[model samples]
Target: MLPVTVEHAAQTPSIFLESAYFNFVLKAVYHATKTVLAFLQRDSVLYWPFLISTLAIAWLAWRVGSAAPDPGTKSSWRAFSRSHLSRELWWHPSARLDYRFYVINGVVFPLLAAPFLFGEQVVANILNSLSTTAPGLAAAGTSTGVVITLVFTVVFFVAYDLGRFLAHSLLHDVGILWEFHKVHHSAEVLTPMTTFRAHPVDLLVMAWGGALVTGLATWLFHRFVHSGITFYTFLGLHVMIWVFSLIGNLRHSQVWLSYGKTLNYWLISPAHHQLHHSAEPRHHGCNRGFELAIWDRMYGTLCVPTDVPGRLQFGLGDDTDGRWRSVGRLYLWPFRLLAKRVQGALQARRA
Candidate 1:
């Protein structure tokens, strides 16, 4: 949480000095490039198939006149691209910053957060060892074992999803955490890369929350009532996650795809997420759940797309202007703001 001090800022010029520091930065960038490219893998929502699926859905929306006032699905690719991928949208400064974040955070954040991650099996074993009795479901492959796996897989998915919702809600509701989380809300534009436009602290909170909940749920299941949902995998994630990810990338894009009123109440549509990013006051802090609308519905943060059909602005409040556009500021300002919060709290305590 060190501040980007005057002395530290002054050293920026040394980056071009051709010294060991420059070489190190070059190596980091090289690895980071590869990391950014890895987003195309099956495990990622940015995988080619998933992105293509998103485009297909968006195209369908255009054809049905669901995306805009006029249907353009019948238009040429050039026309569609001009409308959806215009320079004013995709090439906007805010989205450019997201691209930078994806590259930098890809290599840096994982290395920083690796030590804090938990291995699910290891966590399950530890939990089992602490108990006096043997715990675990019937071994894999038998009829009973198959039943245990099938039932608990759904349980594991729900538990993991709940964890995601809880973690996201906290990042929005908690003041101290919200400063770091602002890096995400600062995006004035959304793209698939916006999925990776997260601060490391934000990412850490999500990763830890997922691991802890899933790990504990797995342990409890392994004993019919002890298991990890890791047994089932589709495209490198649990079946639920994989299914949700089919349109997950669209959540961070300009497409206004909704599952309509009925399903929207039960599941999160990309439009549910778009409303979450709305700059309108009422939309702020709404629609925090990733896959389920139940949490938002229970907590009363749900905002169905039909509620506001007019044009919606994105980003933090208008005062932000372009201050968050700098990649360096996006990374450093969270620490500065957080430190200021701590300092102010301490001063108030003394008074």
Candidate 2:
């Protein structure tokens, strides 16, 4: 009996190691790692390769074109790079927490939500309904001409930018939603990876909004014109790839790249985004557009960048409670406060 029991115990570890649950965990970890790496590609703001190249080019151009002395005594470029492109921000404890949230939001949650969202089916149904009511809308899927495709491409770009602008503005204006969005503004230092330092809730909201806009635009184009063509691509990326390669990463960096007041009316500059992260109350709801400043200008939310760069501080003001800086607290405290608010409402209703 003793020998039999000993044999069974010895086999237990092997059994557990080979179990389905263990394999599932391993698979999840592998996929999460892959997703994180993919997002860190040069095209992405989270990575430094493209950003560093862009900075170097800009620095050389500035040195040759401008008469201003180098930005500092020793090496202004070195100081600028260290402050904004530091590995400290990349491997920071807070950034690790953000990466975990990115995995859950970008991969896990989407998989879980697929059944409920039925995004493909929803878009298909909407297209079908529109086609039935408006026959011209169905014409978009018929043609494969270059001219038609170019028009659709422009339409999609405009629609996407508009949708993002609306969603960003709402996140700032809505008090309850701002609680989740504030997680992003809590950053003390700005790095390219700081772009990913968003709460899962905020990510979900932005994604849904973008999806809806893109879906609607596609349907409209298929109904009226034709599907878009990608003619100008860099490494199979859209034409907009150059935008990211050139200036997107700078938006979240310490570097100030102003488009001037006139150009800023049409386009968003790096300095404009930095102002968005400014701790000042006046800047709180300004410059909400993602790619273009057209929406902000139309909606009266545009705050043009100045020639003189302001001394700006980031993060929520007066976070003396410390919850804003702590990852665990940031994730949990908001939900708890929400729950209490719900409970209070229920009690008041009953009374």
Candidate 3:
């Protein structure tokens, strides 16, 4: 592996800028549209299965049940689409900031993780030591077939979800972290793109932490149990592809698709996530799980929604001072806050 030297790190920013500007920015509008479509159709939170299912259920409910279309709207479909895809929200300057940051993540996060990628060797060494001390662990490194591979896939998904749940909780509980996390919550409207509105700092931290957990789990599974059992991936992603294609995109959508009282205890619905984004003080820090509600249930953070969805106002409320509304401030202001925090800490120490 190549060493991550000062010269390499220095060159990364320029490399990223050149690649991002020429390769990314030049085609950003196209990519951004593609990205939004993908979110709506396949990946991230919104998947086609979930979308079709929600639409089908909503249509049925409108035709047969008390759930009716909004009074001013032409139909239920139009009302639902208008609520989630209003031009003001989709074309908001803030949404553009999200696309820009998405491009930045594509370029920057890999460079940031490059140095730490070498730590895999250290983890391998530790696994070797453990295997040497525990002969049973040596069996873990042995090659295995389809059954064990399936088991490993289950373990991988659980570990990934656990990491996401922890990182999300910390983002809410920690002040400095919340400063960065607030960017996602600052969106006044809910769109699939709002899912990408994450601040880079928040994204990087969660990405690194989640990657570490996943890498370590993978190493342990391969080292101790079955080396041949790898991720059960579809389109190069783990089970999340199914999750996204099923009901994941709905998590960030205005659609109110709940798994109901009993099922919600097992699976998190789109309504569960929309409730999490609710600006109500009661909803703050309520549902933190990414793909599962079991974590929230385990941690006493779960709040099941009613059969009827409630109206929600999204955003961070008055604490933002409107600074979060600007793309420039969204990128720069977090660093400024961090600097002030460091200076204050230094002064307190001296006193």
Best by lDDT: 1
Q: Sorted on lDDT, highest at the top, how do the candidates line up?
A: 1, 3, 2
Candidate models: Cα lDDT each = 0.79, 0.66, 0.69
User: What are the per-residue Cα lDDT tens digits for candidate 1 across 1-351?
Assistant: 889887776676664365667766876886676676665677777777788888887777666666664544445666567667789988898998888788778778866777887755666678878873764455343334666667777877888888888889899999888998999998988888888888899998888777777777777776555333345677567877787777888898777888887998999898899889888888899999998899999999998778436566888875874689888888898999899999999999999
The runs of at least 3 residues in candidate 1 whose Cα sits more than 4 Å from the true structure, single-residue gaps closed, are 1-34, 71-79, 133-145, 224-230
Q: What is the C-alpha lDDT profile of model 3 across 104-203, one tens digit per residue?
A: 5544544454464433335545666766656545555556677887887788787777877888888988878887888788877666667777767787
Say which prediction, candidate 1 or candidate 2, comes out ahead on lDDT: 1
Candidate 3 backbone overlaps, count:
5
**What are the root-mean-square deviations of the candidates from the true structure over C-alphas?**
8.2, 6.0, 6.9
TM-score of each: 0.84, 0.77, 0.74
Model 2, C-alpha of 232: deviation from truth (Å): 6.2
